[model samples]
Target: MTATRVCALSELEQDSAIRVEVEGVAMAVVLDSAGEVHAIGDVCTHGDISLAEGFVDGDTLECWAHGSAFSLRTGQPLNLPAYEPVPVFAVTIDGDDVLIDPAVKKAV
Candidate 1:
């Protein structure tokens, strides 16, 4: 599938995550402290909580419900409870637009 425009790059605050859905797939779009953009499955692997509502530390998104920190580059949880890795999608930045294809996952 083609990449879908989720939101503007300017809409994302640095070091924060925002929830976005594309074709029924929930995802978390994160702008890291380094000014890099990342897209990962929104649901925490440990629970039904949204990762977008979690904390951003460097390149990881930590689940607010359980404190499992997931790597923004690979979606791997760095702590217990969440042993499974969320799907990481490819992100494309065009001008001010942030595009993501739910069908395209970044190979870790």
Candidate 2:
């Protein structure tokens, strides 16, 4: 799997999500409230909206369009309107850079 550098760790705010593209795959990189970083599919399974534009609550990300909340670590939807789980990617922190492997999705 090819590891692509998405962003710098300093570029991410605490408890916020950022939109990124790795090899044409849209992804949402989140820095949860607990100061942990996670990478998941950017699109909301319930709608066509981007998850990075949603709200970050702890380890969960709430989609702004349909109000579907998803677990950052597992990519499982925590609410209705979204039954399918999003893909979760593997993340690596190399010094100040945040690297993501779009080809290496974490198994549910």
Candidate 3:
């Protein structure tokens, strides 16, 4: 599937995450301090919590409910209780637009 426009670059804040759904797939769109954009599955693997509502520390998004920090680059949880990794989607920056394909998982 073609990558669909999720949000504008201007809509994203540095070192934060926003929840967005593309083609029924929910993802957390994040803009790190380095200015790179990342897209990962919004649902936390262990407890089915929303990872977008969690904390952003460097390249990891920590699950607030259980303190499981998942890497934004690989989507693997760094701590206990979340052994499964979330899906990391390939992100595309076209001008000021941030695009992501729900069907495409980045090879980490």
Give all TM-scores, in the order shown.
Answer: 0.98, 0.96, 0.97
Q: What's the CA error at residue 42 for candidate 2, in Å?
A: 0.3
Quantify all predictions' global Cα lDDT against the true fold: 0.97, 0.94, 0.94
lDDT of 3 by residue, 39-98 (tens): 999999999899999988889999989999999999988999999999999999999999
Best-fitting candidate, scored by TM-score: 1
In candidate 3, which residue pairs get closer than 3 Å at backbone N, Cα or C atoms, i.e. clash?
none
Select the stronger candidate by lDDT from 1 and 2.
1
For model 3, the stretches where C-alpha displacement exceeds 4 angstroms are none
Residue pairs that clash (backbone atoms under 3 angstroms), model 1: none
Better of 1 and 3 by lDDT: 1
lDDT of 1 by residue, 22-70 (tens): 9999999999989999999999999999999999999999999999999
Runs in model 1 deviating more than 4 A are none
Q: How many residue pairs clash in each candidate?
A: 0, 0, 0
Writing each residue's lDDT as its tens digit, candidate 2 over 1-61 gives 6899999999999989999999999999999878788999999998899999999999999
**Which RMSD does model 3 reach against the true structure?**
0.6
Off by over 4 Å in 2: none
